[model samples]
Target: MTTVHGSSYRFIWFGLEMVSLFIHFTCLLPLLIGTPVTRAFMPRLNGATFLGPSNALSPVNVAHSRNRGIFCMRSNEMITVEGVSVVLLAGGVGKRMKADRPKQFIELLGKPVLLHSLEIFSTLPGVNRIVIVLDKSYRQEFSFLQEEDPRIVFADPGKERQDSVFNGFSQTLPDASVVCIHDSARPLVSQSAVLASLRDGSVHGAAVLGVPMKATVKESADGEFVLRTMNRSRLWEIQTPQVIKPDILSEAFALVTEKGLEVTDDVSMVEQVGRPVKLTMGEYTNIKLTTPEDIGVAEGFLRERAEGKL
Candidate 1:
């Protein structure tokens, strides 16, 4: 009985050794054959397909092919997907705020209001580039912000908001696909609103953000008398992050320049060209900080967001 038990133990040990050998072979097989498989599947290397050492198939030669598929997929997807460009108009003088600093440069919480506006666009996955129109004297300040994110570019501001937007668009003319014009004073612009405008522009050529007016609007010839009461339903308070295709926007701006027309926003320029601009509903809390009172409102909004009330 002892001899029979020893023979059974030897047989079990041999079986275990064979299983270990099989597992090791299975693990090494991929390393051995990965290069041939990758070379066979990869497209020819040329100027367009050259990915250098960071290329997906490079891993086949380096024994770390785990992220190869991801690299390849991203490269292919980026080639076809058009990205949106954003133009932030930061040239306003901030006369209403009664501050020495421009409204965009004013400190909100701890950071500058303009920095917060740029951060919102910087965080978005679809935003490819950002152009900031600033006062010529503040070029140094904008340069510091550009250093923080290379995606940000600077433009010389014009006398009016329309001119500032035109200058920003001109700077981005060569590369921008869809251009989104936003006010730097409106720090509460959300990712949803930006994405919504981008998508609408992609489909319909132009779009703008606006909130339906709640108060009764009136036209008055004198301080004491109201000439007419306007329908609130037809009235909307316009906001920023207005998006349009680059070519359409360029044409519209050209028309406005030819006609010697001064408009408030890019949407008006597009409208002057007879292009229909779609409206996306914007949040009431997305207010532009025009006065000192608005700063308190912004602080309250920030506190609410911190407390999970937004």
Candidate 2:
């Protein structure tokens, strides 16, 4: 647990409110003035349109949908992902990196690697709360930072990744309608991509992001030889920020606990409980940092992004 001082805490909390209010009003003002302030870039292809707003989940028809091209954002765009809580899992020891501290505490560009995802989630209009799940040992190290943001709360992680998420989910507020679980290592996940998952998940019972499979895959009986070639067209490389309705998630998790099943990702639980999980468009730039080599790659990606080359 962490303690926040009186006036300083108030300032940080109040500052967050002021900033949130400013963004909320500023983004909405465009709609009142009748201007195209932004546009949602949906799927790329015309046929298997994963990028464009696939048919919305709402029974009521949505206006301003773009066809096979660009989707612009008007000033009065009200289709936003708000009042959701994100559980960022940073419980791993990251033995692969072999750092003195865990990978989450390691410095990336200027701030800690975990801060990269935290900063992005804090600014999104759709997200109201953020929960960080840390290993029991790391709690004391992370405690002081928790007081910096009023919207943030901490959770004691479990031994498994799923356990960490389950632990974090337990701490969410009763009013949180949407629940999002993401990896702390994937600092580059875009706000638009996350919003897309939330928007689509609101319609479908659950939604997740998956990159299309471009490389050939092989399934082997053992490490000795390759078995057969997999159909890449049907495969998608799964990624995080898996968003879903709170009740649906709760039900799925309940089933998981009852059956004593082990799931690597939240979607597996949803699937086991007979819920459909839809895939929305996600950026290819989203990468998970697991090893020392990945640090160089992430730095390069950040540099290219800064230079407008990515």
State the lDDT of candidate 2 residue by residue for 218-281, as single tens digits: 9999978999989999999989889888899899989988999999898889999898999876
Give the per-residue lDDT of model 1 (tens digit) for 1-310: 4366887999999999999999887666657877443343344432233232323211111111222211122223322214668899888888999998888888888889998888888776556678998877888866877778877888989988888888898777476668888998998876656655665566679988888899989999887899999988899999988989988998998898899999977899999999989887777888999998998889788778778898
Best by lDDT: 2
What TM-score does prediction 1 earn? 0.73
Report lDDT per candidate: 0.75, 0.76
lDDT of 2 at 256: 89
TM-scores of the candidates are 0.73, 0.75
**Candidate 2, run of 10 with poorest lDDT:** 67-76
How many angstroms is residue 309 displaced in model 1 relative to the true structure, after the best TM-score fit?
0.9
The candidate maximizing TM-score is: 2
